[model samples]
Target: MDQPTRQRRGLLIVLSSPSGAGKSTIARMLLESDKDVTMSVSATTRPKRPGEVDDLDYHFVDDAGFDAMIDEGDFVEWAPVFGYRYGTPKAPVKDALREGRDILFDIDWQGTQQLEAAMGEDLVSIFILPPSMNELEHRLRSRGTDSDEVIADRMSRAASEISHWPEYEYVLVNRDMDQCVAQVRAIVAAERLKRTRRIGLVTFVRDLIGPAH
Candidate 1:
């Protein structure tokens, strides 16, 4: 007999890493390859830049609107960055979860912690680390977009960020980008198949046995 289809709950996949550690690249590849996952659009208080769509690029709101959301508990997690507030809105995320669609988050360790506190069971947090601090600095220098002073600052912050690797459910050393991406894909596959997430399994099994059993 053909097997019954199983419906699973969606996952909140979080990728956190220091600058130049390759988390962003991995996230891009995952989204490109997986139709079920999409990047999380953050609500921001920053003014919309030229050519940026309000809801597609970000949910742009004024300071008062953002403050109202915070007061009303409409955000899963939020933080101020360079004088502007950015946050994951709760409604879209909840809708995605109910529809069994995965959402990818590219945030820092602190935001990951807040998300975990809000939705621990649904979160699959991963931290990416460079193979070595020296390699990390090399990657930053190779970008050629920063001054020496900025590179030094990033290196300093990288140390602090790397210290939080223990907080994540998975930690990957990005020695090889392809290999790392494969590992992340594997993690997503396994997490999707977990028994707790497979909400339709009980019914599937019951239907398999039939009424005569």
Candidate 2:
């Protein structure tokens, strides 16, 4: 007989890293390889740009609409950036969680902290690090897009970001891109199998054992 499928609650996967640490590359690889995982679409007050679709590209709203959401406690985390407000809406996240669909967040430590506070049990936080400071600088320089001044600024900020590594549930050193991505995938797999996240396990085990007197 075919075994019954085990339902599980979805995961909120957060990936954080300093510039040149390969976090974005790892996130893109995971999304491309795993159909079940989707990127978190943030709601923003910024005006829609050319060719952007509503609710797909972003849940674009005006200042009053955004404020209403904030007043109604609709956002998990919100912040002002360059005169525009951006936030992760609670409704879609709750819906995804109930439907057992994973959401990926590419956010910084502060945002991760807010998410952890709001959804700690369902959240899996990972911090990616460069193999070394020298290697990080080399990677930045090799990009060939940034000026020497910009590279120095990034290197300075990288130190501050790396200091928050201890706050994450898992820390990975991006010595090789493929290895780092594999490690992240492994982490997601293990987290999905956690007993707390797997729903209906008690009944499944009980059925296997049969009814007791």
Candidate 3:
């Protein structure tokens, strides 16, 4: 006989890496390919960039609004970043998880630490690493998006970000995009099967096995 369907609680999937390490690219690929996983839109005081949609790209709010949410305990975790404040709202994430829809977070190591403290076992964290420092600098320059000074600043910050690799449960060296994405997908698949995540497994198995006879 076929097994009964077991219910599962959704996972909070987090991916962290320094700029130009292809973290954002991997995240985009995952969101595009996986129907069950969705990005966790954060609330931020920063102005929306070109082509960024409100609530989709980010829930852009003002300083006053951000402070009000902070005061009301609306955020799971929040921190000042670059001259602005950014945070993941508590309600939507919890709702999604209860509905068995996985949520993806693309945040820095500091934010990852905060989320780990707040969400604990619900979170699965991964860190992406550049193949080498030279390759990292090359990728940053190849973008042609920033001036030399900005690139230098990013390189300096990359060292600090990479130092937190030990904090993640999984680490991937992004030498090739396709392979890196495959590895991440495999991790997500395996994590979904973890015994703790499947809430209804005991009943499903008991039904399959029959009552002690």
Candidate 4:
């Protein structure tokens, strides 16, 4: 069987938030629902969590390996957060974009900045915040992955992260998980309909005009 032609003109979605602000959850759902979209796997210096496979949850690498890629200009964006380094590779994302498949990023604000600088107009940025500070604290504590001290530190850092909401094109209050996911899906749908991303649509329009009489 012949393979289908790759898509053209994809979206670059930047979904950013504090450690426990639900950006990751929404990103996962978006990926699940949309065949045209996929996550931009990040390269991290941190060790893989249990059952985490490379190139899935993250691409775990050694310092020297990551640094070598950095020196080679292999990352579209990179940042050092909480003692661990993380970066978005330059190639896969670009290739996905060229093939007309949208890529979602679950990075923090700093990484989003680098992506914006790199992808420019191709980027669609969103910031997610908890319903309130109390709720955020609660969510962080409930995760059970980090200790009290770590959770406290994360909550403290969250304030700074949430302050950057105005910078995002879309701000979502993750009060209700399903609703927020729907809202995000709607945004993606609208973005996909954007004229600039529809090269074929331009040709379709010209055809509609019937050779300019």
Best candidate, TM-score-wise?
3
RMSD of 2: 2.7
lDDT of each: 0.92, 0.90, 0.92, 0.87
Model 1 misplaced stretches (Cα beyond 4 Å): 1-4, 46-52, 210-213
The digit string of per-residue lDDT tens for model 3 on 1-213 reads 434344688999999999999999999999998998999999999999999999999999999999999999999888877678899999998998898889999988878998999888999999999999999999999999999999999999999999999999999999999999999999999988888888887778788778794
Give the alpha carbon lDDT tens digit for every residue of 1-213 in model 2. Answer: 213335899999999999888888899999999999999988999989899999987899999999999999999988765468888999989999999999999877877888999999999999999999999999999989999998998898889889999999999999999999899999999999898988867667778778791
Give the least accurate 10-residue stretch of model 4, judged by summed lDDT.
1-10
Instruction: Tell me the number of clashing residue pairs for each predicted model.
Output: 0, 0, 0, 2
Model 1 error, position 146 (Å):
2.2
Candidate 2 deviant stretches above 4 angstroms:
1-5, 45-54, 60-66, 80-85, 147-149
The local lDDT score (0 to 100) that residue 37 gets in candidate 2 is 99
RMSD of 4: 3.0
Instruction: Score every model by TM-score.
Output: 0.90, 0.86, 0.95, 0.93
* Pairwise TM-score winner, candidates 2 and 3: 3
Clashing residue pairs in candidate 4 are 7-99, 7-100
Model 4, 1-213: lDDT tens digits are 111212248899989888887988888888889887888889999998889998888989999999999999999999999999999999998898888889998888899888989897889998998888898888888888889999889988998988888889999889999999999999988887777777676556566667784
